[model samples]
Target chain A: MITMIELAESIYEVIKDYRNHDNIFITPENIIEWAKQFEDNGQLVLTELNKIIKETYISRVRAKEFIYEHILSYLKLYEYSSIAQFLIDTEFIDVQQIHKSQPAILQLLEEVLTEKFQVSYLPYKGFPKVNYIYFDDILASGSTIGRDLVIFLNKKNSSGQKFYQLIQSNEIKLSISVFCLHTWGFEFQKYRIQKEFNDKVLKKINWFWNYEIQNHAKFNNQKLNIAKPVKGSSSKINSYLENLSATKYEDYAYRKANTPTTEHFFTSAENRIRFENVLTEKGIDIINMIKGEAKSNIRPLGLINPQYKIFGLGTHFFTWRNIPNNSPLVYWWEVAGHNWKPLFPVANRGN
Target chain B: MKPSIRTYQIKDVVTFAKTNGEFGALSNMAAGFNLFINEVNIQSSEILYQACRFPLFPHIQEEIVRTQNPMDAKKVSRKYMQYSRQDWYSIKFKIMKWCLEVKLVQNFDNFSQILLATENKVIVEYSTKDAVWGAIPQDDKTMLVGQNALGRLLMELRERVKANVINKSTIIFPPNIPAFLLFGCPIEEVRNDDYFIVDLDEIYA
Candidate 1:
């Protein structure tokens, strides 16, 4: 069994930033005890797993820099050219917003932009319709943006005329400037938008983002074949992958990625205890957990209830703000008596 | 922390190939770039150039492929496994060596010296006789197309390499064996047949 001292040392080695300080959630001392819970046959060999947990973490420092360095700097450049008029998604303007969760990024953007540019939300009424730039942190499926655009365009004005109707009649051109796009989602939505609208409507869109990772169909197919079980563990992660039947999650297209995303593998303090309890009961059959054919006691993304066609586990995205629910049940989903702990603790649980 | 899976981006591949004088690969890349342009109508190789710079994350790659209606994820998996088993560097060297001997590439010595110079510049100094066409152009149109294609390829390479020289990490590519196949394969033929742009705006729109 690895000692608390050993676990702390291992964590420090990987998370160089946390050597002197504790993370917002898991501290080195806390992680040591947490590591003990995943012991297999009374042998706690979570050294590598601990390393993974630390490596996957994106501290607030890094997250802020990503926003400022990549996204905002580019936006500022446009502002300098006097061509940019910033608009945010209307969802950020919530009526019931507590603790100012709404428009936090916008507020930050405003502070950073330093009054050089204008940032506002829609029903952009009385404002001169310039190059309206919409900002969002991430785009996983592109469905969110599509839905948002549909809503924005369909919104009826005071005279009962919809914005989209006017645009369709060539009364006004609705040019969408998307920043921070996930390329796969972008392509999928791009195809849909073009099909939904005619050639003229499709011409007025521009996309600028930090980077687009490999999510093309051609590239992902190759990755699926090589997706392996996590190395050096007692869990049946590898066996589960090998035995996963094609028939399972057959209808849900997105679940087919085979390997769960690396981002979802961290353990929160609360989840660590619950997952350990489940681990004691289920005894490490990750494949069965994923299959979820017979057992109810599984991870959040694990239950495969067929509403979303969610694969039981794995997502590629990571953010400092919170672990996405779309990730595997083991990553963010936590429920008591289920013995389900998550790698990253979900923020605003039960919301 | 667990190390994320390392991926080779297009930029890394071009940097290596350009620096090492893999003329055949450049030809294939140029053809692919041309195909991408013909489909998308982008004036520059910036998309593929940018894509080349993007990392090839297996998780995203697997997800994207599986989502296809035909779902040839298994074939992709098999190919990936095959690639993992081979020595990537050895394969790269062998392919380059073969291309040189077969004259699929010309002006290797001159190109290599320029590429390897301390200043880190690519100087392509060649005469008309140095042309190593994959096949003889039968008509003026074909010859013009060939020249334009090669010209575009060379220009893009110089610009891309200059922009990307700062990436210090060494990268390797999966050998496109039967090296002639690499040069001859059109981008359209290799890309997902179902996935095509209905309108140029469908891509960026």
Candidate 2:
């Protein structure tokens, strides 16, 4: 049981630089005010919120060090492994083929690389290329990374050689290096890429991530450790789902929260449900505030594809750069004059 | 061999239920071969198939799906016998076959490779009591006897795998029937397992 003041202070410390209007970079008071929306469960919200901040939040320094470890130190060992035989069999690391999901992380990666590799990553094209390593904050649904790769692979460079052609030919390879990835979304992303190219380019692809969240609930054996509350858990949640546009109702979103195989992400199973319920309840309240025709992507927890129709993607991971749209709305939903203030003012949303 | 029985030398057939068996990945009870049907994560095909028995009682399906072990999931289903769908007796085998098909499609790479490894040798589910889904050791301990419905379905799956037709489908149609409901929703077609690939063992424990 954490006091609101103590929890708010710790949260403010972690996300102090979250951008705001006119010197409004988030403060402790702001955190307290936001939790009050939950009323009697306000303390519970703060308790869970504090848990999230303590366990999930990433500061700038911490993220940069991670980038160094994955891209340089860890990747070195990977090069000679059979998993990365394609990298060695083909050409040198394609240092310049950086797919930056956002400019800041790429810039952070470049800084980290320059410190270790001791070379300029940019302005050095035409080097013997083998693999492309993408650095991003987190891969929530994999749509952003998948879409980028699809567009990049389908398009030809100045030489009229499609990137997919290069990959299929084994002349070049691809690997995505991200901070964290969801087990379900990671698979879906790979599936999307292969489907786009008709399975001709998967062998050339490799994936590296420091953390993977088992948030998927498709399997009966799966215990969803992430924030998926069961339907009928509360009248409010049911009413919320029932209120959705009839033509756009998403039935798949109304699944019961499965037990996680292990309780690694949340502190405990009881706490996990309490946290999910409060956030989902508040998430619905927050979205209900949207003026009219709330965008299809606007979900209680976070944003997803407009066509997805599910309550958000329920991604809990965060990075130094920003929170992902796939995260719950309680973490990053910010709209002016809506009487709502997201503690972590997200950086890149709706891109 | 009886008309329904397909006897196989115990040494020639593959058996799975335990996670460590050579072809254990083919077992509906095996861990790590999680399926995502209709954009939902099912821990195994056994759980999903069992959950299908009580579609009208979604809460029971939810309880069944929440069980970590497939055997436990079956217990959960049994506890709610009063809520079992009326057509369960007639459609049970078809549902089991559909569930296995889902397991095969969702876990095509590993499951199919293992199914193919059986290599036309009569596949058998070694059992002592259950004759419907498995075979029992006959008087001769060297061979087995029973309906072996699971084994037959698996052999059919091996052919489908060799056929390589349904592997790419984004959605799998349910067995054409009067009604197939899971979680109170009509079963149309489930999303292909290709959408997500769980790098098991590498999976976060």
Candidate 3:
């Protein structure tokens, strides 16, 4: 068995060749130790994890093409519908807070979707607004869309129409278009929106996903169930999850499905303190624990969303520009002069 | 004739509820709590059995039978959100809170009857210090969704289950009457008069 230090060295060898603009903090050493503590069946080695990171990492070119083609096709299909008449007056929205910060895909959409359909940025145009499509990269818990909608609803447009008034008067419809959507998140949003809004307003809402992941953790889907911790680890993980703070509504967003492996071990720097306390209580160093006999619970998935019950590690989805905040805090959270480094640096929010 | 009746423990009910259908016996949990919850109507307390309760917890339901396929696996997550023992207690507490908030029942006895409505396959016998109020049907085809109902509507369900199951028990109580009953199934194949009770008191204790 490789020591934690050795494992870190091996990991460094693999990641060294990859791009590094903003230096990520967590070393291969930090990860190996964390993994040893978290995974029960301790067979995972540095080489395997390195392989997963290299293979799963999404590059800028691939992400742009995937978004452009999927959105373009979705728009083409809707072009012939009677709703097209209403949609021609549609306005594209920044639902994910990505328009200014992570604008590569959005720019691509503007180039292709705008050219294909008669679209406008502002609502001041004489055409009656019929459709509003909010674009984002991922939808994990599904609350962000509702949150953005609340923001949009309160803003008065150049036309002096409250977005909420347009929605109430049946003058406009709302929809969400995304690249990745989890099954549980989609249903939660569906039930929540239905319960909150009237039928007419609900009827005008739509959800479209380029890739609909049916990883709800309930079914016997072997591929998706890969994250379930076996016996010894299962109990430890369960207790850890059960004890997490459930103070917020989003914190309560848990389903029976196996917690996605993509969720990170820690959500943020503050979350790390509590997680470290659990390790301290165990009184086991990274190198001395018994070797695991089961499959590692961690997934090779690239992205993490701390909002997910997993403390922050989520599914393997990633984008080219910046790693999402949803990814494990270990990979993305960084403070000046801090030992912790983000493997995938996030886009500067000021942009 | 009266509908056959039996008693079960909540622990056994939890086990039976988790048996997975297609994965072979003991391979997977049959279905989650959501499948059972969808069939219940708390406000009306109306018992519905057919596609929802056919064979009273068959690997498949009427909808699955008619569709000739298993229920969509994706839906199980949304309906059966409880994953652990604590999760189950949390959901039960939610139902209890809802019952109280909605004024579904005035007292704890009637409120406890809501527990009888936990599963699709149930034998509910409602009574008080004086008389037996009503009982759910025991048949291969029919079962109860709600443990007890308050009015002419539940009277109708009781009649339907009894008639369809070829039993002849009449509704004996008035609406808003308070009563309690135990829910259970046979331990194995037994006579209509015989049943194996799960000793819910001990299990809960």
Largest lDDT belongs to which candidate?
A: 2
> lDDT per residue, candidate 1, A106-164, as tens digits?
55444444433344333443464423344554454554466566566666766898766
lDDT of 3 at A64: 55
**Any runs in candidate 3 off by more than 4 Å, and if so which?**
A1-58, A80-88, A95-104, A113-128, A150-171, A218-239, A242-310, A335-340, A348-351, B1-205
- Candidate 1, overall lDDT? 0.36
Candidate 3 residue-wise lDDT, A1-351, digit = tens: 566567567656545423343454445655565456445422242333443454344554455565666555545645635334534566666545544322555676655445555553333335655667677777765556655765676667678987666776867666677777766455445434333343234445667766654544422221331122222333544565565442222222232233333433323323333333333223212211324521122211212232233433244454555555434444554446544344545656442
- Mark the 10 consecutive residues where model 2 chain B has the least summed lDDT: B196-205
Which stretches of candidate 1 lie above 4 Å from their native place?
A: A1-25, A41-57, A69-79, A82-102, A114-126, A156-187, A198-203, A211-313, A349-351, B1-205
What is the per-residue lDDT of model 2 for residues A1-351, given as tens digits with 9 covering 90 to 100?
Answer: 668899889878877755432244777898898888777877777776666665566667777787777766435644543323423343323223233335666677667756766554564444555666665667877766766777768878569999899888977667777778876677566555654564447546777777666655543344454686766559988777666653322654754544554666666777777877888888988888889877766778677655454676677777655677778888777788787777677653434
Global CA lDDT of candidate 2, please?
Answer: 0.68
Candidate DockQ values, in order, are 0.04, 0.09, 0.04
In terms of DockQ, the best-performing candidate is 2
Q: Could you tell me how far off, in angstroms, the CA of residue B42 lies in candidate 2 after the best superposition?
A: 13
* Model 2 TM-score, all chains together: 0.63
